[model samples]
Target: MYSYKERSHIFNTLNSYAFDVLVIGGGITGAGIALDAASRGLSVALVEMQDFAAGTSSRSTKLVHGGLRYLKQFEVGLVADVGREREIVYENAVHVTKPEWMLLPIYKEGSLGSVTTSVALRLYDRLANVRKDERRKMLSKKETLDKVPFLKTEGLKGAGYYVEYKTDDARLTMEVIKKAVEYKAVCINYARVTDFVYKKKKIVAATVKDEISGDTITIHAHQIVNATGAWIEDVQALDQAQKKKQLRLTKGIHIVIDQSVLPLEQAVYFDTEDERMVFAIPRDGKTYVGTTDTFFEDDPINPTATSEDVEYLIEAINFIFPEQNVVAQHVESTWAGVRPLIYEDGKNPSEISRKDEIWTSKSGLMTIAGGKLTGYRKMAEEIVDKIVKKNRFKHATNCITQVLALSGAKGLNSKNFEDYIKNKAKVGESLGFSYEDAKALTAKYGTNVDDVFIHAKNHSADLNLPLALYAELSYSIEKEMAYTPSDFFIRRTGMLYFDIATVEQYKSAVVDLMSNTIGYSDTEKLIYQTQLDLFIDDAKNPK
Candidate 1:
């Protein structure tokens, strides 16, 4: 029922009516909170400064598992909590959240030994309530090498195979927003909360400015939840009644490379020279190896991956798999995100706890911070529970998101995904495309593939990439909130990381599709093209 006109209508009505809850920050946490509160029959309005998941949500290492490394830190509660939640998340978005096997390569002098890793995997499986399908297995050196031929055998002892889930973090965040919309929540991206509206020294509402259209408006709410992740401190500063503490920001960077370059059947988890863990995850026909954790005090909005960070990842990857020797040239794209860990005296970034803490000011402005992706739903439930208790709402029900199916998640099963693609391709053949192209398109769009076919029929015929028909681009703009080519390529279709050359080659055609579908003018299209080019340049020569 949500459309472009409906979105505009809700935006206009936000200021007119006092909402039951106004959630700030449109990251996964904010989106989850909105969906949770709205599904409980509470009127909700959620606002974001940029696009949905434009912040830390999209910049994650893109894993949805219990922190395997946390076991090293002896954070048993945190690991168990995340493990239990991972199952709930996987069930909710079966298509986007699939089980992936992670191999922890045990070197002779590595931080963790084969015996220790085997025991830990057993403990993890028990704690996570891991089903038979996702049980862990221990592998000998020969078995490990057979699974991952790239692994260096010089210092290998064995490997621990454990279950983990991978996800499109951006798409998952957006799907949460879509579900919130279905539950009748008013959600608007590109809207910034400037100042808190106060009534007799108590926070009552917020003054917001639309970043895109430059329009200002005021939205009234009984309670405001600031779930801005790294920016929580900044939002909290607006409340003079509360004490402001500096948040510890840690930069985590990931480098993408073609899977064929270092093809591994499973994700590789290995210990770096510094004793910290690093992951090489296979994703979308590419491999994402990363995440160097370093303290950062720079701009959190646009944190850039330094050359040193990339070098560190390359060194760690090459150290684990000497045969591959992954160098700078092997990297296709690199991205960095800031983790807003609560500052603790004399503690390093790696030692910081991943547990979330909720803070409420005397004026009743609630802020939630310092959680990972797996616990977002739990965080949302706790936030809403506090709101109901604070407001003394008598009719609020207990959280139901535990069983709620996100949009497009209903009737989803892994067994039928292939069949669904074939059916979509058969339909796509009617719209001037080969079976191969149709298969590709259907795999990307799922049940929504029909929308793309309709778009191709209505739009111009000479579309670039017969596989990427006009309909898919139009569907992205109209339904997925894809305002720019980067939004489509980077997040929507995942072409930015998967096939960088294809994105560059079809830039003009994509711009034309955006213009025709989203009502972008020629001047606006040119501007978007320039922005995309600069983004590509930045990806090439990351700051």
Candidate 2:
């Protein structure tokens, strides 16, 4: 029932029933809360102003890493908590998360020397309770160069080798929300909460506007949670619950280049000349590197990579991989997102703590702000635990999400996923898919690839589109509730960023297919088309 066609029923359900919880945000945090609350037998509803994971949740560095650098900031607890949860997250969503060995190359003049990095990683391993097989390793300079031959060798001392989990952030949020829906949580995107309805200074309902239809409705709920990340203050002001402490937004950008340009075979987490850490990781024949953390005061809705940001990352790439001689032209695409850090006086954007804080307004609107992607489940558990203990919302149930497999992950574990995908690929090959394409689809969708293969089998011959694209679009529209071209290209398929050529090659066909399938009006089709064009242009040509 979690589809584009089911939105009317979702809205009706929201309006007719007084839910135990109404979560106003649909990023990973809100999705986590929805899943937690719903799994605990609470009737839950969630609303989002944009497509799911359209904000910071989608535009992360795409690592479920234990913040090793935070050890420098003395954030030991945060490091331990999010660090240990990495394996749990990997176990729960084996399809979206994978363990990547990260190399931290140490230089003569670098802030961290071999000894210090070794100590830090050891502390990190103990704190995170890393498994014996995946613990930290100290590599000699020769070994390190063998691992990543392109590294700068003039001042190289050694490197710290450790494990980090890579993830598709947007898909992770989607799977979490889909799992919540399976537990009967009514969630809708493109529904913006305009105002809160208060009775005797207690929030009882919210005035929400359907962004697509320009229609309004009031949803009744016993408890309302404000999980809007960067826009927390905006919603707080709407509730007239703006607090003294607020969000300090920071912008981070990443640049993607073909692997041929940089040819980085190993993932490197290295320090720039300015001593700030950056990551260069290879994915599907393209190596993506990023993330410049700087204060941003403009609109957080659509953060764009400035020329300065691109140049900074390019310089970092060249500084480490000097043989590559990478430049701006090598950049295929870029993405920028804002961090909704809780405001801290006199701290730089990077220095601000990543800890999450929960606050309740005078009208009882609970808001959560400032957390990492890896800590979402724990954050949700804490929030739900508070709600249950504080108000006795319903029959309290213990958190079961620790062992819960997300959508597409059922009956699959990290140990068995390789074999599962191999076996499933043969089945997909029998259904008009190439061996390689079948393997890729099986890997991406896990057990849910069965459903996607059905879509391919049923419609690929008739669609005049790539079988993979057709199947993905069909699955996204019917199961993932992708309503717009941007939702499909940017968040759902990630073609806009990782595989931009695929987007450019198939944009018109995709738009036409979506229009005919969903019956978009001519005006809506033009708007959606223009929106996708802007995204494509922005990815190619940064601000």
Candidate 3:
């Protein structure tokens, strides 16, 4: 309900208030910080240069599980904390996060032997406080192939079965920001912080320009936090802070192929010949595999999957699943994301740890860098606690987000999401959605589906678009603050990655609706149109 529609009164309120906290990024880190600070009774203001999650947040591998591979690096505590948080994240956002059993097939020459995987998983379960029934189990060679029939049978001693959480990364960020807004936090998209506003050489506020309207405003705050992922150094340059610590950027690319091409039934995490690990998981009628960790020396904002990147992943997929002869031509879509990790000497991208660190500049600006998606909440809690102690704030309360559900997850939990959807989908069917569509929408939006249902009903007659498409588009415009066609197609609905055809089918109609809804100038309309076209081309060609 905390809509960020263009020209909304939220902007006026943001320009007028000096909040307790001002977050400079709208990625998952900033979104989590906003929710934690606001829920702790602090007034918070957050601004993003692009749509929320447009950076590393949306382009991640989309898993919320503990970095089990970190065990190789002896990062035991990180594994324990993140592993435990996996359940917490899933419980709070059941609609967007769910448990998937992952199969780890052991080969004779692989990095993980049968005994090592079992012992490691057992340690992981105990440290993660896994429920009794969900503990890791050792599957024999026969049992492993039974679960994953396509796994390379040669030298496959056995497999380890364990639970991991799958999620929609962008939707998870959006829902978290929405919940923060519910707690009275003010957030706006497409607003870039051009400079810092300092008094007596201490940072006090920021100079922000609306990326859409081209109007500028100065936002004052008691404390400022920098959570800009990948671009943290850019914000640090604004602060003129030099430190011994720095961020090392690496690029990871993923490719999506239809099930008819890969047909991966089980989520497999296998090692490549070079000792690098990759995941091939099935989602939304497609089997998407990826993540090549190579040093990147390009723009962090829009990292593209080069032909070499595509070739490396294609080789990995074919190596593990010898039966599926997938090639670059079979790739339906691709996405590239950059990870900003703390600089570690002599360590390659994959060798670096995923742990996060918070550093305070002399100007009182706090910058956080080098964290994984699964550890966002804890990272926020740590940063906010530092702010409270340094500022001597009193209105703050304890962290309530551990138990507090996100926007649509309120009044629902992992145990009841299925039943809630079963009952609520009938309501969507009544509003002209087919039963399957109703169930699908209800599953994606959780309790918020009811609001979308209401919006769809109001637009039943006049729209020339599909009813399902209309409901989603209308809801995104009016309720989600999506002002551009790219926002609607890419972040709001995730059609760009999961279902690119739908985006291609509805691009013109969606663009026209948004242009009219937002009152875009003819020139602005062309810009938005070109933006959508660029995104479509990038999704397919990747560069």
TM-score of each: 0.95, 0.99, 0.98
User: For model 2, what is the alpha-carbon lDDT of residue 214?
Assistant: 89
Off by over 4 Å in 3: 4-8, 241-244, 460-462
Please, what are the lDDT tens digits per residue for candidate 3 over residues 1-543? 555454557777788988999999999999999999999999999999999999999899999999889998899999998998999999999999999999989999999998899899999998899888788999999999998788889999999999999999999999999999899999999889999988888898999998877889989998999999888888888885434367899999999999999988889999999999899999999988889998887888778788889999999998988898988889988889999999889999999999999988888889899888999999999999988875457869888888989988889987889999988888888778988888989899998898888777666445568887888888887778888888888788888888998888878888877777778999999999998898889889954
TM-score of structure candidate 1? 0.95
Total clashing residue pairs per candidate?
Answer: 0, 0, 0
Question: Across residues 7-51, which tens digit of lDDT does each residue of candidate 2 receive?
Answer: 888877788888889999999999999999999999999999999
State the lDDT of candidate 1 residue by residue for 1-543, as single tens digits: 444435566678898999889999999999999999999989999998877887888888888989978888899988888899998998787656778889988888898887898888888888888888778888999999998887888889889998899988887887789889888898887789999988988899999997766788999999999999889888998886775556899999988888778786689888998999998988767889878888998778877777889999999888888888788988888888899888888988999988898888888898888989999999899999998885546667789999987766666566777787788788788777778888877665555667667766556456654545456677767776667887777666666656777778888888876776567767778888998887676566776
In model 3, what lDDT does residue 150 have? 80
**lDDT for each of the candidates?**
0.83, 0.92, 0.88
Clashes of 1: 0
Q: Provide the RMSD of all predictions against the true structure, rounded to 1 decimal.
A: 2.0, 1.0, 1.4
List residue ranges in candidate 1 displaced over 4 A.
1-7, 243-245, 414-418, 429-445, 463-469, 521-526
Would you list the clashing residue pairs of candidate 1? none
